[model samples]
Target chain A: MSFAHFSELLEHIRARRSPRRLAVVAADDPHALEAVLDAVRDGVVEPILIGDAAAIAILLRRLGERPDRFRIEDVADPTAAARRAVALVHVGEVDLLMKGRLETATLMHVVVDRSSRLRTARVMSHLAVLEIPTYHKLLAITDVALNLAPDVEQKHQITLNAVEALAAMGVVRPKVAVMAAAEELNPKHLDSLDAAELKRRSLAGDLPGCLVEGPISYDLAIDREAVTLKRYASPVAGDADLLVVPGLTAGNLLVKALMFSAGAKFAGLVLGAKVPVVMTSRSSTALDKQMSIVLAAAATRELVHG
Target chain B: MSFAHFSELLEHIRARRSPRRLAVVAADDPHALEAVLDAVRDGVVEPILIGDAAAIAILLRRLGERPDRFRIEDVADPTAAARRAVALVHVGEVDLLMKGRLETATLMHVVVDRSSRLRTARVMSHLAVLEIPTYHKLLAITDVALNLAPDVEQKHQITLNAVEALAAMGVVRPKVAVMAAAEELNPKHLDSLDAAELKRRSLAGDLPGCLVEGPISYDLAIDREAVTLKRYASPVAGDADLLVVPGLTAGNLLVKALMFSAGAKFAGLVLGAKVPVVMTSRSSTALDKQMSIVLAAAATRELVHG
Candidate 1:
């Protein structure tokens, strides 16, 4: 099944047989706690808050929740909290991992630690699902938060991570558009060359789960009118479920432009790990965090079943 | 004299004491002729159509214009028309060169030909002026249509070309934001390193006539709320007149996104030549082309007088 909106993702997660447990690292942040409380209330996820139990309870109570109503761990330090959360995931106690008030580097360091048992052979990549008002359906963009200047091989890995995550979310065959300045392959443009190679690899079944088209401009990738005007025909053209940007700068700008300028709503996760990791900015709204939790829940269900 | 809108640019050119003459190469395209006709009607420019006189007349007649209303040169071949336009500029017969039905490379080949008198000591770069609804004033993006992957030196030249063009358009000292993925400098991100060097050079007077800030993200560069939230203080922050993107891919995507997704109106020109060249896409609207002509007219006046 294909999701037309992020709300549908939330509804799908709500309809699951049981709520997936989330081990939230450094959960003392008010914004994160509020989202967790809402998800818990909506029967989306069961939360295991891994920060200072006293602080989490106070923040939860300030939102009019009873102190003892939710599970909480009294790890006062941020680093210790992250370690505990990772440990919970390692022992199969939690279905998902979340970053709360703690610094992403602090939590990610432990999560990727060899002894932590959370690291996978695959590279970790950030996958953002954007609900753009102008787009026909939710669009996924990858490596906007990580991978500064990914090479061709790393791009392959990044593409796989996003494709697999979307697959888990019921987009069985997502169309991926590897974007560049223009659709034509030019030797001077490394991005275009990489895109062409990626497209070739995708067609050869190197990337099995999605249809990939590349060396395409941003307008042709997402706008049907532009594709028609330019006479550029491809299955991914004008209907891309995922946009694999050339680099971090392009991806960062594209995602931020959609969110801050075009009024796009988004949820992001760090994939390619043992489990989906919900990592959002502290300034993000509670609704944004809740959507991320829902997305994570769905990915977790797929990981367990697939 | 920082104008807040493209209409101000149009009005500025219309108010000039004398209209600038434009030699439009391969001038049989309906879109290009329509825009040129509008500019002529507005008294912003005088046109010398240099393509097949018969085809030009037919298009003019279709647009309800008389065949004898404008000067027409019958160079039927695209290459010959481009050469003729370049020759007209070389001998100071026309104030600007405009591309009509010909491919961009066809015209640019003649414009940058070393044997051609239109070639200047400076490198040519595309300058786009975007009137985004959310922006406070016209935002100029550089090298969007030229210089695919400009190095640091080429970037410096591109930035200079845009700053000089904006200065000619009455912006005494244009504030340029050299864009990157993040505000902080990182060794891993070459754009950031280049941005830092450009900023240093701007401060050291290598890039004069502009206030430069860089290693800055798109949000903090244009959004005051983001600047305030991120605590990024700079004269160019939130009020940048020009955004020098890292390369062509980033710049092209940015300008196109502003146009197609953000409902922005735009005008573009090729600068750092003997004369400003109007080289808009054939698919561009009449208004877009007309604005580009106005911009080129303004730049021509500055080139002659400054």
Candidate 2:
């Protein structure tokens, strides 16, 4: 079922008649433990914490979390913990993977390992879903933390991934804004050229599931006044839900700018993988981490179990 | 001459005794003409309209304007009208140039011509000043519209250009946030690498007149909580007045996102030219144009004619 507010997703996870099992890799870090503990208490997820059992137990007790109520997977080595998390997902033991204290590259390496069950034909990329108080709809930015330098084909999949995720979250047909310097192809600016090409692909049915318009500047995409005053004509001009940036640099800067300047609330996840992955930034608050888990659970429910 | 509030600049422009000379090229476009007329009525400027005189007369009459009240330079050709606008600025006849019905590149070509007085040793770039109600201080974004692909040296110049303009508007030392994808130098992302180098250059006085920090992602640069929580150290972190982007695409999207999603009011001008220039998009409202005129007048009064 499509969801309107993130709270609706929280409701679904809470009921979890068939709970979405989330495996935490190297779940020894205090912050990571705190987040999962909160999730478990909320009853939105069934946890399979994979790491040093003793350390996790001590940290959980410090936070007043009881161990008898939760599932613990003790793996001494951090790498082994990562391997076990992926192994759980591969064998259909878990529905999602949450990175804990381990480094991202290490966890990602194991998740994408050809021998792992989480491997998929499509490349993995990060997607950030933002909730700005000023915007009427949620703002979706892709490949901000992952897929550093994606080419045209990778970008194509990235767009599809975000659209599907949003569609699964209740957006019937997300208006995709292909961001660029100008709404025309300029050789000196490769992004604009790429934006134009992407629009063509979307229109030609190469990229299904959404409406895409590109080679368009930022203002024309989201501001109805800008579109009307500037005489800009595009169906996706004022009501865009997903913004497909030209590259990681633009996506990263765009998402962070809104959060920092406008006090926007956000949740991020890795998509196009075999399973939904939760990977919040280190700077994210406890609240932010909670929101991300909620987001991942909702996305997983919509995509895999729906 | 520096201003802390946008209203302060507006009041100063409203008080100017000698109205600044404004040359309007191809003065037949409805939106462009409306903005120019509004500026004239506000006494912020005195315009010399150049285009098809008959068409302009009709447009003015339709707007209930006194057709013969202002100077009308009849040029049947739009390209020639654009050239005249630049020529007037070159010859000290006008303080700023505005594009009326013509294309932006046409006016830029004449301004950049070596033979024109509008050409200067310093490179020209675009500067957008935002008066967002939610924030305490005005936010300035540079190199958003022009400079498709700027290198490190060009970015340094962009920083200096923004600082000078903001200083003219009353910021003593504009805290400049050099934005990139990540908060640290990752060898793979060139923007972050360049940001690190730019910061070093600022310390060495190469990018003089501003506090520069980069490889600093958007959130770390503007969000105080994110800064304190993440422990990212830099004066620019929570107190940036200006944001210098790595390229046009990132910068353009940022300004748009803020305006559309955050309800920001903005005014922009072309900097590093011989004179302050108003380069509003053809679709801009009269208020946007009037605000741009006020900004240009104040910057001109302080930077060029002080």
Candidate 3:
């Protein structure tokens, strides 16, 4: 069954036989470690902290946790810590990866390295899952934090990645709304044109496991009254499970607006990787980071169960 | 003083000594007439209805009002009604225009017609003003419904138009935030590049009467905590008055997300015309339409007083 709230994901993960292994690269970051510890207390994840051991121990002790209570990998340098995290993934010692105090580029560099076994054939894309109070169900927005200005091909890949990730979370045949400024296919707006093409491909069974609707405005996508008022007929209208934004700019703005202005709680991860990657911004709240850990663990459980 | 809420705009307009004449093109539409009637009751505008006279009279009677209570221009054809509205503007018989049953393109065609005498030297753009509960003050987002994928030069023009519109609303030297996916100046995202250039030009005194900050994310633009967390130093951060979007897609999505998800109340008008135009969508709430009328009347009062 699909989850409606982020809290539901924690229950789903906890029902599993045991906690999933999570590797925190450059794990001395205070906020990241706090979230990891919160998830550990929630009995969802068994985190392997990879960073400066002294720093991690100091942070853990400062938080009133014993250093010997958790696994700590001593890799002082951020790049080496990223490599160590990737190695743990390759050896099947970790089920997922989370970025900590290190720069995202450093961690991503190790993941995408030619020799790294973590690279998947699919293009890696970020998927943000938001629990917006105004929306009836959890909504997923894609490529918000990654893929600056993806073209049609990249958007196609991103859609595939999101669909697969959603499937792993038990949301079969999710309704996907390819977002644009308006419902009409205006030639001046490439987003509308791309949306039409994506919908066509979806109808032809090219993009699978999702009922895709396109060139739909945000109001029509989430507001049932708007759907009725505008006379827009689509199964996805006002009940979209996934919203594929035109680009990162729109996606980022939409996600943050919901979180900051609409009081939405969010958790996001990088999909299309061999393992889900928790890459929330440094400015993200502690609860958001904890939710990401729970989401990663839940997705991992689904994959293993299958 | 600038308006912090739409209700304040009504006060500003009602304070005026005389009501301004408003021309409603193709005014047989019920919702449009309802809003016009509301404004009339509020004593902000004297509306001249230009459309099918018999249908307008029937609608007025249905709404429990007499047709002769207001001036009625008997132009049945939508195109001819648009022309008549522009002609009234040319002769200074009306202070503003509002779209009714006719297509926007038809009204825009007449307004931009070479002989229409209503075209201004500036590029016409749509400005949406929102009063979000989470934000301390009103925020304005631009070019959501008008410009599609504006280039750097067009963005510069759009910013100028927004600045002028804000000034007319008593917002002097407003803080303008050029929105991007992230605060960093990334070359791959042309929005960031354009934002950097806009900031440079603003600092160089090319764009005047505003404090411009660019390459700023939505969170930093409106969230004080995010600004402190990210250590982003900008006067506009967390207190932006105007948010200049990268293009129409982002702007539309941003505005709709705030209105639909964040519970924001919004009113918008088309600037750069000889008179402000209330061009809200057909599905816009009656309250929004009424507020747009109030906004237009207040802006007209400001212009006359200046």
Candidate 4:
């Protein structure tokens, strides 16, 4: 039941019985309000706006929407909004949390605080689901925005978080490609060694419900022609559902190249928390923000809440 | 005189009065021969094919070309062919070297050997000249194939190599972006630290003939909208001529994404040597291979030989 496109994910979410409750921290943000309005109009999410109530109302009115129709909390301070959103997650009031025009660090600190109740045993990581025009289906890339230089163990946890999140989204047995420079285990390259070790762990069933293959190059992972040409034998080759980049720099560069150069549409979410978090960048398009909200709503159904 | 596209580069080389002599190691490769034939027909290059003369002749005949029309050195073994190619470069017989049907390690070993006399004071690095549809002009990415995790000094050399090569090809004062996950100096991320150091060096005139900016992310480097959206201040921000990656993994991922997902046409060459070396990947299209030859030839005329 994997999604081939964002439209499919949107449709899948809309078909659900009821809209999920979403907490929009710093909800005074116009861009966030626009996306939330679209999601609400689509019957995908019921938003609990937590920010400067007066500002939110004004912005909502400016957009030709009635602010009185939605619930609004007057937490004017950005940190307070973030704290309130996390508090909602603690009391089973919100199924997901979203950052809105606030400093990401301000929201992230509250979300990952020891007392934030949104903390899960697994380390939180960012997952970006991209709709590349050239690809056959939706591809999920991980930790592009979060982990700086994740080691083997951190990457292991990151992989599990993505695999579980994708599974929750109806992707059965996601094929994961632990990306490296090339598809060979070179002693000189720690990335290749890390990839090989992850593969070994996958084989040991440490990373269950996923087929992990690596030290795979980008060409071998996505291009079947390259698989056939290089004669690289792996199930994950040419049909990767997930790409776990070696570090943040690689993943960030890859995603930007896809967006700016490849003309890809993407939706990003922060996983490994008690609830999924939507933190789209300011540069993200309206479509990207809408798709992210839809994706968050879709992934929210089976995930654990307070 | 910077090239806007690979066609412009081809035109630039074809406009030259005399064609540069190119030595193709293990020249029996069909793809290599096809590209060479195209370059020859375009009057851009005079190829000195060094490989098993029998196989080279057979391949030439198979491709509907005459073997007798071109000079073929009958070096039977791949290592011997690589050695002979390096020897030609030593005595100034050829202005450029192109790898054909041989292990890259074999050719690279010969080219980098102290006795081979191809080594320069600077570390040899691989540069990919990409003609992306979305970009305004050709973008050069460095060290995607050669250096693994280059230190700041090595990266300095790598950047110098790319800047010099682009300058030779008529790109004046190339704008270089030292890529990172974000455009901030973070103590935790060595990539960011390295980028800042490089920028500092560039400011001190250590990296002459280029505008080096860094601790910059991909979106800011290539997308003007992102630059405005983020309010990132840099001249190189929306119009980078070169991208120097933190390491091989990041660069390789970036280049592959541009190639496979972005539908970019690219040609690769090894720089910092006495002469530019064409070493296109097996998966490169014919245009890419031919463009590599053209690029090598254009770069060769201004580079040191003998």
RMSD of each: 1.8, 3.1, 1.9, 1.6
The candidates, ranked best first by lDDT, are 4, 3, 1, 2
lDDT for position A171 in model 1: 85
Q: Report chain A TM-scores, every model.
A: 0.96, 0.91, 0.95, 0.97
Two-way DockQ contest, 1 vs 4, winner:
4
Instruction: Supply DockQ values for each candidate.
Output: 0.63, 0.61, 0.89, 0.88
lDDT: worst 10-residue window of model 1 chain B: B297-306
lDDT of candidate 3 vs native? 0.88
Candidate 4 local lDDT, residue B149: 88
Question: What is the C-alpha lDDT profile of model 1 across A111-203, one tens digit per residue?
Answer: 888888887889889998888777778888888888887899999999998888887778889999998988888998999999999999998
Tens-digit lDDT track of model 4 for A1-306: 667789988887777757889999999989889999999999999999999999999999999998899999999999989998888887889998999979989999998889887888898999999999999989999989999889999999999989888887778899999999887789998889999999999999888989999999999999999899888899889999999998888999999999989999999999989899999888789899999998888776643553
The TM-score that candidate 1 achieves is 0.96
By descending TM-score, how would the candidates be arranged? Answer: 4, 3, 1, 2
Residue-wise C-alpha lDDT for candidate 3, range A1-306, written one tens digit per residue: 567798877876777657888899999999999999999998988899999999999999999899999999999999999888888877778888999998989888888787887878888899999999988888999989878778988999999998887876778899999999889988888899999999999999999899999989999999999999889999999999999998888898999899999999999998877899999777789999999888777666434532
**Clashing residue pairs, backbone N/CA/C < 3 A, model 1:** none
C-alpha-based local distance difference test score of model 2:
0.79
- Model number 2 iRMSD: 1.8
Query: What local lDDT score does residue B149 receive in model 3, on the 0 to 100 scale?
Result: 83
Error of 2 at A114 (Å): 4.3
**Candidate 4 per-residue C-alpha lDDT over B199-263 given as tens digits, one digit per residue, 9 for 90 to 100:** 99999999999999999999889999889988889999999999999899999999999998998
Q: What is the C-alpha lDDT profile of model 3 across B139-237, one tens digit per residue?
A: 889988888888999899989988887776678899999999888888788999999999999999999999999989999999999999889999999
**Candidates 2 and 4, the one with greater DockQ:** 4
- lDDT scores of the candidates, listed in order: 0.86, 0.79, 0.88, 0.90
